[model samples]
Target: VANKGLKDLKKQVEGAAQDAVTAVGAAAQQVVDQATEAGQKAMDQVAKSTQETIHKSANQASESFSGFGKKLGLLK
Candidate 1:
Protein backbone atom coordinates (compact mmCIF):
# COMPACT_ATOMS: atom_id res chain seq x y z
CA VAL A 1 0.00 0.00 0.00
CA ALA A 2 1.25 3.53 -0.78
CA ASN A 3 0.32 4.60 2.73
CA LYS A 4 2.40 1.82 4.14
CA GLY A 5 5.37 2.87 2.02
CA LEU A 6 5.02 6.49 3.18
CA LYS A 7 3.40 6.33 6.54
CA ASP A 8 4.98 9.54 7.99
CA LEU A 9 5.52 11.39 4.68
CA LYS A 10 2.36 13.46 4.99
CA LYS A 11 3.34 14.80 8.41
CA GLN A 12 6.88 15.54 7.27
CA VAL A 13 5.66 17.41 4.19
CA GLU A 14 3.25 19.45 6.28
CA GLY A 15 5.96 20.43 8.75
CA ALA A 16 8.34 21.44 5.98
CA ALA A 17 5.66 23.52 4.32
CA GLN A 18 4.99 25.31 7.60
CA ASP A 19 8.68 26.08 8.12
CA ALA A 20 9.01 27.52 4.59
CA VAL A 21 6.03 29.78 5.09
CA THR A 22 7.36 31.02 8.44
CA ALA A 23 10.79 31.80 7.00
CA VAL A 24 9.31 33.80 4.13
CA GLY A 25 7.06 35.75 6.47
CA ALA A 26 9.93 36.59 8.82
CA ALA A 27 12.05 37.86 5.94
CA ALA A 28 9.27 40.15 4.69
CA GLN A 29 8.65 41.52 8.18
CA GLN A 30 12.35 42.28 8.65
CA VAL A 31 12.42 44.29 5.41
CA VAL A 32 9.46 46.38 6.49
CA ASP A 33 10.94 47.06 9.93
CA GLN A 34 14.28 48.13 8.53
CA ALA A 35 12.67 50.46 6.02
CA THR A 36 10.52 52.06 8.68
CA GLU A 37 13.48 52.61 10.99
CA ALA A 38 15.50 54.17 8.20
CA GLY A 39 12.63 56.49 7.31
CA GLN A 40 12.24 57.63 10.91
CA LYS A 41 15.93 58.36 11.28
CA ALA A 42 15.94 60.41 8.09
CA MET A 43 12.93 62.44 9.22
CA ASP A 44 14.52 63.15 12.60
CA GLN A 45 17.67 64.46 11.01
CA VAL A 46 15.69 66.78 8.71
CA ALA A 47 13.65 68.12 11.62
CA LYS A 48 16.76 68.87 13.67
CA SER A 49 18.38 70.75 10.81
CA THR A 50 15.22 72.78 10.21
CA GLN A 51 14.99 73.66 13.89
CA GLU A 52 18.57 74.90 13.92
CA THR A 53 17.92 77.09 10.89
CA ILE A 54 14.78 78.55 12.42
CA HIS A 55 16.55 79.29 15.72
CA LYS A 56 19.37 81.10 13.97
CA SER A 57 16.97 83.18 11.89
CA ALA A 58 14.92 84.09 14.95
CA ASN A 59 18.00 85.23 16.81
CA GLN A 60 19.08 87.43 13.91
CA ALA A 61 15.61 88.94 13.57
CA SER A 62 15.43 89.67 17.32
CA GLU A 63 18.82 91.42 17.26
CA SER A 64 17.78 93.57 14.29
CA PHE A 65 14.51 94.51 15.98
CA SER A 66 16.28 95.44 19.20
CA GLY A 67 18.74 97.69 17.32
CA PHE A 68 15.82 99.50 15.65
CA GLY A 69 14.02 99.85 18.97
CA LYS A 70 17.12 101.48 20.54
CA LYS A 71 17.37 104.00 17.71
CA LEU A 72 13.71 104.93 18.24
CA GLY A 73 14.22 105.38 22.06
CA LEU A 74 11.86 102.47 22.71
CA LEU A 75 14.46 100.04 24.13
CA LYS A 76 17.24 100.70 26.69
Candidate 2:
Protein backbone atom coordinates (compact mmCIF):
# COMPACT_ATOMS: atom_id res chain seq x y z
CA VAL A 1 0.00 0.00 0.00
CA ALA A 2 2.82 2.44 0.75
CA ASN A 3 4.46 1.67 -2.59
CA LYS A 4 1.19 2.34 -4.37
CA GLY A 5 0.87 5.73 -2.66
CA LEU A 6 4.37 6.69 -3.68
CA LYS A 7 3.67 5.78 -7.29
CA ASP A 8 0.51 7.86 -7.32
CA LEU A 9 2.33 10.85 -5.87
CA LYS A 10 5.02 10.60 -8.49
CA LYS A 11 2.44 10.58 -11.26
CA GLN A 12 0.72 13.65 -9.81
CA VAL A 13 4.00 15.54 -9.58
CA GLU A 14 4.85 14.73 -13.17
CA GLY A 15 1.45 15.89 -14.36
CA ALA A 16 1.77 19.16 -12.48
CA ALA A 17 5.20 19.81 -13.99
CA GLN A 18 3.87 19.24 -17.47
CA ASP A 19 1.00 21.63 -16.87
CA ALA A 20 3.37 24.31 -15.67
CA VAL A 21 5.51 23.97 -18.75
CA THR A 22 2.49 24.21 -21.05
CA ALA A 23 1.28 27.34 -19.29
CA VAL A 24 4.68 29.00 -19.60
CA GLY A 25 4.86 28.21 -23.27
CA ALA A 26 1.43 29.68 -23.90
CA ALA A 27 2.38 32.87 -22.06
CA ALA A 28 5.55 33.23 -24.11
CA GLN A 29 3.62 32.78 -27.35
CA GLN A 30 1.16 35.47 -26.30
CA VAL A 31 3.98 37.91 -25.67
CA VAL A 32 5.47 37.22 -29.08
CA ASP A 33 2.08 37.68 -30.77
CA GLN A 34 1.57 41.02 -29.10
CA ALA A 35 5.01 42.23 -30.09
CA THR A 36 4.45 41.22 -33.70
CA GLU A 37 1.11 43.05 -33.81
CA ALA A 38 2.69 46.22 -32.45
CA GLY A 39 5.50 46.06 -34.97
CA GLN A 40 3.04 45.62 -37.85
CA LYS A 41 1.01 48.64 -36.72
CA ALA A 42 4.16 50.77 -36.56
CA MET A 43 5.18 49.68 -40.04
CA ASP A 44 1.73 50.49 -41.40
CA GLN A 45 1.89 53.98 -39.94
CA VAL A 46 5.29 54.60 -41.49
CA ALA A 47 4.03 53.50 -44.90
CA LYS A 48 1.01 55.79 -44.67
CA SER A 49 3.18 58.75 -43.66
CA THR A 50 5.58 58.10 -46.53
CA GLN A 51 2.71 58.01 -49.04
CA GLU A 52 1.33 61.31 -47.71
CA THR A 53 4.73 62.99 -47.99
CA ILE A 54 5.16 61.83 -51.57
CA HIS A 55 1.68 63.07 -52.53
CA LYS A 56 2.33 66.48 -50.97
CA SER A 57 5.68 66.84 -52.73
CA ALA A 58 4.16 65.97 -56.09
CA ASN A 59 1.41 68.53 -55.67
CA GLN A 60 3.93 71.23 -54.76
CA ALA A 61 6.04 70.43 -57.80
CA SER A 62 3.01 70.56 -60.14
CA GLU A 63 1.94 73.94 -58.81
CA SER A 64 5.46 75.37 -59.16
CA PHE A 65 5.70 74.20 -62.74
CA SER A 66 2.32 75.69 -63.57
CA GLY A 67 3.38 79.07 -62.19
CA PHE A 68 6.63 78.98 -64.16
CA GLY A 69 4.78 78.18 -67.37
CA LYS A 70 2.50 81.21 -66.88
CA LYS A 71 5.45 83.51 -66.27
CA LEU A 72 7.07 82.30 -69.54
CA GLY A 73 3.82 82.99 -71.45
CA LEU A 74 3.73 79.31 -72.33
CA LEU A 75 0.40 78.82 -70.54
CA LYS A 76 -2.70 80.92 -69.97
Best by TM-score: 2
Clashing pairs for predicted structure model 2, backbone only: none
Clash counts for the predictions, in order = 0, 0
Model 1 Cα lDDT, one tens digit per residue, 1-76 = 8986586888888899999999999999999999999999999999999999999999999999999999999999
> What are the TM-scores, per candidate, against the unseen true structure?
0.76, 0.92
For candidate 2, write residues 1-76 as lDDT tens digits: 9999999999999999999999999999999999999999999999999999999999999999999999999988
Worst 10-residue lDDT window for candidate 1 reads 3-12
Candidate 2, overall lDDT? Answer: 0.99
Clashes of 2: 0
CA lDDT of 29 in candidate 1?
Answer: 100
In model 1, the clashing pairs are none
